[model samples]
Target: MGLNIGTITDACQWECVNTGTITDAYQWEFVNTGTITDAYQWEFVNTGTITDACQWEFVNTGHDL
Candidate 1:
């Protein structure tokens, strides 16, 4: 089946990145738009609080988490 865009929200404090790790604080409080996993913690939106166009280019490519 085709997977659609999904959203994610971490209960604990976390920062979304392209990959995940023990050192990677589990604070990925983000809206998972697709196949996001524990290894994908380096794809966080580091654009600060300036919500606007081009603010969603923080995927860091298809790199491993």
Candidate 2:
């Protein structure tokens, strides 16, 4: 089975679990592939102006999935 989020439009929350044999899924990400939005974008303080800054890097090499 699979989950298809192709029809979702509004804000919502969802979760997924792995039942396959990928036991070493120790890394995941929340990559924003869209334009700079307020709720999910990073900014810096320069001249009191906020703009789209560099993306944050996250990694967990020692944790198990």
What are the root-mean-square deviations of the candidates from the true structure over C-alphas?
Answer: 10.7, 15.5
lDDT of each: 0.35, 0.26
Predicted candidate 2 versus true structure: per-residue lDDT over 1-65, tens digit per residue:
22322222221222223344433222212233333223322221122212211222222233222
Candidate 2: where are CA atoms >4 Å away? 10-12, 23-65
lDDT of 1 by residue, 1-65 (tens): 01113322332233233333323223333444444445433444434433321332344345444
| Model 2 C-alpha lDDT versus the unseen true structure | 0.26
Q: Write down the TM-score of every candidate.
A: 0.25, 0.21
